[model samples]
Structures are given as C-alpha cells and as structure tokens.
Target: MFFDLALVFLCIAAVSQFLYFLLITSNHKDFVKRYNRDFKEFRPKVLLTVPCKGLDMGFFRNILSLMRLDYENYNIHFVVESESDPAYESLQRIIDRCRDDMPAGFAKVLVAGISKGYSQKNHNLLHSLRFAPHDTEIYAFADSDTRVSRLWLAHLMYPLRNSKYGVSTGYRYFIPARRRFSNLALSSMNAAAAQIMGKSKYTTQVWGGSMAIRKELFEQLNVANLWQKSISDDLTLSAAVRNAGYKIRLMPRCFTVTFEDMSWGQLFEFGRRQMLITRVAYLRMWLWGLFCLLNHFLGVWILPVAAAVRFAMGENDAKLFAAAAVIHWASLIYRTYMRRRTFEFVLGPYGGYVRQLSMWEFLLNPLWLALMLALILISSFGRTICWRGVRYRLNGAFDIERLNR
Candidate 1:
C-alpha cells in the first residue's frame, strides 16, 4: 500500500510539472509576439556596466559582441579590479579596434579597486557606476561570461519605457563546449532554470547577469547603497524594488548565451555555493528548492527501492510502482525536449551557441537531479561560501561576515 501511494504521488507531481511547463510556454510565446510587433523609438541614454575578473574561453568574442551592440545612444563602462587583470589588456584592444565605429564616448574600461567585504561582482559595479555618464537614463548590467546579441539591449530597454516597470531582466542558458558527461549533465540541469525564471510570474527576483533598471528608479531606491549592504546584487536589487512597490518585467529573447566546460566536481561545488547563497539571500526560495530536491530524490532513488521490496514480497500491486518509475522517466525526458525547443526559439539564428540536444542526454538528468539534491542537503547545514577567492559567512540576507578578502 505504501509503494502504491508513493507511485500515485510521483504521477501527480510529474503531471503538475508538465502543466507548469505548458504555462511557461504560453507566457513566453506572448512575450515573443509583443517583442516582434514593431519597433519603437524608445531608446534612452544608457550605460552598460560589465564587471570582469578573469577571462572566459569566449572572453574576446563576448566583449567584442558587447562593443558592437545594435542599440543607439548607449555608453559602456567595463570595470576591472586592477590593470593587472588579464581582461584589462584585451578590453583596451577591443575599445581601440572598435572606437572609430562606436559613437563618441561609447565605450571605456575603468580600473577600479575592489570593495572590501563584498562580492567581487558588486565591487566592480560600484566603480562602474562612479564613471557612468551624468546624462545616462538607464543602467544595464551584464556578466563577463555571457555573449549578448546585437538586439539584446533594445529588447531589455523597450519594456521599461512604461512607468510601472521598475526593472527589466534577462536569464541565461548554458551550452557545454564539450561532449563530456559532466558538462552535458550540468548544462541539462541549467536549462530548466532559464525557462522557469524568465517565463514565470515571479518578478521579484532578477538575474544580475542580464538586467537593466531606469537610472531614476535606481537612484530613487538608492541601489548603489543597497548593493553595499547585501551579499548578492540580484537578490538585493529585487528586495529593494519590491519594497518600493515597483514591478519587474522579464524580457523575451534577451537570454544571454553562456558557454562552459566543467567537471562533475566543479559543477557540484558550483551548485552548492549557489544554494548556500540562496539560503542566506532568499530563505523561502531556498527551502522550496530543497523540498523539490527531496521530492526528486524520492522519485529517482527511493521509490524504485520500495517497489523492489514490495515485488520481492510477492505483492501483486508492485506493477503500480513500476508504472510510476516509467512515468517519472517520461516526464524528465519530455520536459527536457520542451526546454530544447525554448532555447532554439529564443536564441534564433544564434541558437548554435547551444549545441543540438541528444535524446540520450536526458537519461542523465535524473542523475543530475540526484547530485543537486546531495549538494542541497550538504549546503543546508553551512553558512560559509568561498566565492571568487574570497570566503564569506552568512547569517541572513544582508548579514554577512567576510572570512577572507
């Protein structure tokens, strides 16, 4: 009876997840339609602030892409901690090569020192803002690791012309540079995050890597001051926007393309650190993620064992558990198929950034979920996170102690 009940639970959860996927698809489709309706002359004076520490495999290409944005009337501020950083020279060369093509004052790299007791990303952002043009009307932020399209800025800025939207944000999907199992597994798991984050109704959370805010709105909320007091910039900005009673609009086709190659251990450690930050920054979301992890753990690991135990005991209803196992597998496979479609549709002609998906890769997704569950389980007990060569101990969303700087 217990095995049968677990089977019922598994089937129900699978169906619900499928339904959620459908809803997100509908939302994304609407977004795409509106984005393509027509062009508007809503471009504002904008500053794109990108913070860099180390170079990625696509670092040169990524920076070049940013330097060649299709948008008009925008200046870029690339902030590095020191002239000693590897990216400094590369950025200088890009600016020199692209300067003649760019509008006057269009791109400049700033050498700013780090902010003590804060995340490196935020530290760089603070300095970038210091050099922002006095007349800039919009503040845009991007991560150094992502490659943005020519129209990425236009899409992000178009939605914020409305007075009600406090922020506009974009999410990223990862593509593995190699066919290694570790790389495929991690990339497979990351696709689900992009869909949920970009398509869902939740506007309170933003992705720092591809986000924009109106300059007046940012200053009204004192976002720069807020960043100083928080651990993660995205969560801090989200909370401040909510407190100010403003809305966040998720832009369509504004997803950044990320290329990565990592081993299983590196991927696992990355997942844990993310969860630990979530644990401090957004406790409720962290707990909900943990619950989902536990549920997946049961569907993938525990229920099968229970089914086997019942079958070995000569139970006639053991087949129900077997059916549940089949349903779980089908759900994962189908969900992954939908995610691939989402990527291709959004990324468009540039979709090649994400390699073609293979049917066999979905089989490893269950293992990915299991490993993520293990990471979550381990992170639930810890408050310390080693990030970008600095260690931090957390007590709450904004309460943090710098263990190392």
Candidate 2:
C-alpha cells in the first residue's frame, strides 16, 4: 500500500513538472512575438539610474558597459548615498577614465541624501530623480552590480514607445564565480527559477536590477508613495503599474547580468528575504514558490531515493524509476538547449550538484519555510527591515516614514 502511494505521488510530481515546462515554453513564444513588433520613431530622452551602495565584483566593467550603450540620446546617472562611500571613489575613477570616450550627455554622477524608506536603492533613487533631465521621457533603473549588453538600452526603450506599456522588465543571467560548490548551487537555482517565472502569464514582478519605465507614468504612479513601505521595490512597482491599468511587459530579446557571489549563509539570508517579499507582493503566485521547493527536492533527491526503493522491491518495477530518471535528464537537456551558450555550460554540471545537495538542504527546507513565514508575519505586523547599513520602518498602509534618515 505504501509503495502504491509513493508511485502515485511520483506520477503527480512528474505531471506538475511537465505542466510547468509547457507554461514556460508558451510564455517564451508569446514574448518573442511582441519583441518582433516594429518600434516607433520617437527617441525619448533617457535617465539611467544606478544606485550604488558598496563595491561589487564587476562594478567597473558593468558601469563602463552602460556608458557604451547603443542609444543615441541617454544619460547615465550614478547615485551614491555619501561622498565618503567607496563606491563614490570607484565611480569617480571610472568617470575620469571613461567620460571623455562616451557619447555626448551620456555620463553624470550625483550624491543623494538618505530618504525614509526600507529600500536604500529607492532612497538613493528619489534623491537622484531631482537631477533627472527635465526633458527625460524614460527612467531606467539598474543595480550597481549589473552588466548590460550594448543593445540593452535600445531593447529596454523599444517597449516604452507603446503607450500601453507603463514599465518593461528584462531577464537576468548569472555569472558563476569560479568552480565553487555554493556558487554552482546559487547560479543553477537562479537560472531554473528564471526559466519558470519568465514563462508564466500571471508573473508580473520586475527584477530590480534591470527595469525601465516612462518618467511620466512613474510620476503619475506616484512611485514614492507606491513603494514607500516595500522592501522589494521592483515587484511593488510592477504591481502598482498593473493595478493602475497599465501593462508591465517582460521583454525576451534583452537581458542583464547580475554579479552574485554569495556565501552559503548570505545566500540563505537573501533567499529568505526574497521569499518573504514574494509572499506579500505576489500572493497569488506564492503557491508557485511552494511548487519550486517541491520540484527542486523531488528532481534532485526524492526521485533517486524512490528509484532505489523500487530497485530493492523488484527488478521489473525498476523501469518505473528508470523512466523517472529519463524524464529528469530530458528536462535538463531541454533547459540546456534553450539556454544555449549563455550560462547553460555552468548550469548543466551545476544542476547535478543541486540535486545531490538537495538531500541535505531538503531536510532544512521545512524549518526554513517556517522561518520565512514567520518573518513575513512579523513584517506585516510592523513594517521595517534593516538593510545595507540603515534602518527603516513602515506605516500600517505600507507607506514610508517621512522622517529624514
């Protein structure tokens, strides 16, 4: 009886994974169709905001790449919290070296005063918004650690030409750090998550690292009020745009690179924080989060155990486990084929490790999930999270405390 139940559960899990795979493929095709549409002739002035807190591994290369954008009319605004920040020094060095080489009106840096918000990035952005060119029609926000392709600005701006789209968010590709086990785990997890989320119709949250929107729409949305209490401003902004009857399109043709080399502890903390915010921002999609936990565990650990159990039971039933293994390999191959040469090389091998590591991580997942839920509950009870050397509290309505930080 127990064996029968296990078989049933295995079949259900396999079917759910298959369904998720179909959803992603369909969404990718839909995105491709929209991307092929012709862009309008309007060339709006752009303000690219880079909110810098500290130095990151690819900071210089990322900043330099932005200055080299293919767009004809755009300005890069580097925002820092204080003049004493080490990032300020790095920005100054890059400006001194690259400003002369960039296109006209393409480079500028500003020091911003702290504002009342749980998000330091948003606080820095609000101050820099004051310096935004009055004629600017598009506002682009990216993290300090993100690297962009040459055509990034062109693709980001293309969606804004349509009046229906209030904001456009792009995808993120991970740059693996050496051959470390934790790095591999982090990279593969991100890639798989992106594949699943990018392919969903109801998934509207924008990645904070690479997002673009119209300046007018942003003003209309009253972004300050919209994201005042939000820890994850990107998701909040996307939700706000959708609620305001404006479309938030996820473009397929463009993507940005985020440099993340998190230690095991840091990765856990970051993932926990993300899970907490996701619960609030995408309540409906929270089930998908649970699905992710289950999928990763089953694909990596549970299947192997089930297969072993079947093997001990009888050789004839071993086919059941073999079939499941084939499905797992096929899915990984498909993902590799789809991702192409981008990060698949790393993910292909790393995915195997993810499966092995899950045996251990799965044991702690229940506790971790409980902890994340508790954090969310506590956060809802009060609004504040200490982040990046600052403390911010939120009001009952999720608005930021107006007091100066």
Candidate 3:
C-alpha cells in the first residue's frame, strides 16, 4: 500500500515536470521566432550602462567584449561609484583601446557619486543617467561581470522598437571558469531560472545581469517610484513597466555570459539575497515559491520512490522509469544543446548533468530551506549588508545608508 502511494506521487510528479518542460520548450521557440522577425530592420540610439565597483576577475575582458559589439549608433557607459575604484583604471584602459581602434564615441567612462539606494547598482545607474545623452532612445543595462555577443544589443533593442513593448530582457548563461562544485551549482541554478522564466507569464522581469528598455518609457514610467522599498531594481522596474500597460518581451535568441567561478558560499548568499528581495517586492512571486518546493521534492525524492513502488507492484518499472527519465533528460539535452551551440557550456563533461542534479539536491535538502529562512529573517530585520567590501544599511525606502565603518 505504501509503495502504491509512492508510485502515485512519483507518476504525478513526473507528469507535472514533463508538462513544465514542454511549456518551456514552446515558449522558447515562440520567443526566438518573435525576436528574429523583430530584428529585421530595428535600430535605435542605445546607451549601454555597465555599473562597476572593482576590476576583480575578468572585468576588463567583459568590458572589451561590450566595446566590440557590432551595433551602430550606440555608446557604452561605464558607471563607477568613485574615481579611485580599482575598476576605473581598467575602464580607462578599455576606453583608450576603443578610442585607438574605433572613433571617439564608442565608449565613455562616467565617474559619479553614489546616490541613496538599497542597490549599489541602482545608485550607480542613477548617477550615470545624468550623463546619458538626452537623444538616446534606448537604455541597455549590463552588469560589469557579464559579456555579450556582438548581436546582443541588436536583439534586445529590436523588440522595444514596437510601440507596445516597453522593456526587453535577454537570457543569461554562466561561463564556468573551473570545474568546481560551486561552478556546477551556479550553472544549474541558471538553467532552472531560465526554465522558470521561460515557462512563466511573468517574463516581464529581465535578468538583472542583462536588460534593455525604452528610455522615454523608462523616464515616463518613473521606475524610481517603484524602486522605493524594492530591493530588486530589475523586478520593480519590470513590474512597473508592465503595470503601465506596456508589454515586456523576452528575447531568447540573445543571451549574456556570466562568470561561474563564484564560490559555493557566494552562490548561497546571492540566492538568499535574491529570494529576500523577491519575497519583499513581489508578493505574488513568493506565493509561487511553494510550487518550486514541490517540484524539487518530486524530482529528488518522489520520483525514485515511485519507481520502486511500480517494480514491487508487478508494473513495468523499466518502462515507467525510462519514460520519466527520458522526459527529464530531454530538458537537459535541450539545454546542453544550447550551451554547446552558444559555446557557453565550457565546463568539462557532466557539467550539464551536474548542474541539473544540484538543483534537485538544493530542493531536497532541508538545510537549504533552513538557511533561506535564516537569510530572510536577516534581510527583513537586519539593517545592513556587507557588499563587496562596504557595509550599507537598508533605509526605509530602498535607499542605502552608508556606514562609516
């Protein structure tokens, strides 16, 4: 009887996951088709904002890649909080190189004073906005750690050319620097995130790492109004744009590359920070968090039990397990195909599998839940976060209170 119940749960879980996979596949195809059609003749004045803190890691390489984009009539803005930031020197080097190779307008570094914002990224961006060309029609915000394809800006801006579309966000894939467990975890999380966003109706929110918007709409939408008490500027801005009766498009053809050499501790902290912000800013998203919990439980624990039960019940356990495994594997195979095609799957063999498995592990582990809860507590009650090397307190309205120490 116990085995039968387990089997029932497993079957349900497998079927649900299979349906989820199908949804994502369909959405991905639709997104691609729409994106290709839209980019045919779309061109707009673009300002690419790269918010930087330090020149740690491959910051220069990422910046240089952006400078080399094949788009026309666009300027890259490197927003640094302080003139003495280590990354400022690297930005200067990239600017000089770009000026030497290209013309004077290819890239520019804007040193700005940090403003009051819970997010340092937002603070830097707000400062950069002052220097943004008034004639610029599109705003593309790219993180300093991210690298983009030559066509990234073209693809992202193409959708916004339509009057109905207010914002367009591209996909992100992790470029694993090493074959460490932490890298595997980050990669897996990124894949699952793509799957989730791809399948969901709220594709409005762009990944903070890479997003673009209509400058006129962004100014009219008044994102800073929503930024108040919103820990995540991306989500808040996306939500505001959508609420303003404008469409937000997600272009699957364009993707940004993120470094995947983050330590396990860093990954956990990042995830916790994200969850805390999402929970506070988007209550609806928090409501859907339960589905994630169930999905993880089914993937790791329920499916295995169902296979055992079917075998005990004289059912074709091999066929059942094979079918379920095929469904799960299909999703992985598609992602692996994308990774390979994009050359984003640089990690060694089993990189894709390890990435998928880690998500299951995170879901099944009670420890992760406990840690998340603890972080939520801290994010809610605690005043400050130690970011990079600076500590800033969370003010009443998503503004950061700089600490002396």
Candidate 3 residue-wise lDDT, 1-405, digit = tens: 796567656666756765665566556555454545335488788888888888646787778778877677788788887888888887887787668665225577788765554566777777677788878888888888887766677778777878897778876766567767666656655654564454356534667667888887888988755554445678788678778888777776566666657887787666666665665566576546645555544544455655566668678564676466556546545544443332223222324544554544444333443344444444545545566665656554354565642
Candidates 1 and 2 compared by TM-score, better number? 1
Q: Is candidate 2 or candidate 3 better by lDDT?
A: 2
Give me the candidate number with maximum TM-score: 1
The weakest ten consecutive residues by lDDT in model 1 span: 195-204
Candidate 2 Cα misplacement greater than 4 A, ranges: 1-10, 26-42, 104-106, 197-199, 307-325, 341-386, 391-405
Q: List per-prediction Cα lDDT, in the order shown.
A: 0.77, 0.66, 0.64
Question: Which 10 consecutive positions of candidate 3 have the poorest summed lDDT?
Answer: 341-350
Best candidate, lDDT: 1
Question: What are the root-mean-square deviations of the candidates from the true structure over C-alphas?
Answer: 2.8, 5.9, 5.4
Question: Which has the better lDDT: candidate 1, or candidate 3?
Answer: 1
**Which tens-of-lDDT digit does each residue in 1-405 have in candidate 2?**
796777757756864675577557555645555564434465679888889988888888888888887777888889988888889988988988987778637676788766654566776777777888788888888877777766677777877888998888776766655555555555555655565544454655688777888988898989976665665678788778888988876665456666667786666555555655566556656566665555645654566677788788785666676677667656655554454432332233334444443443334433443444443344334344455666544443354444335
Better of 1 and 2 by lDDT: 1
Q: Rank the candidates by TM-score, best first.
A: 1, 3, 2
Model 3 CA RMSD to the hidden true structure, in angstroms: 5.4
Ranking under lDDT, best-scoring first? 1, 2, 3
- Please provide TM-scores, in order, for all candidate models, with all chains considered together: 0.89, 0.78, 0.78
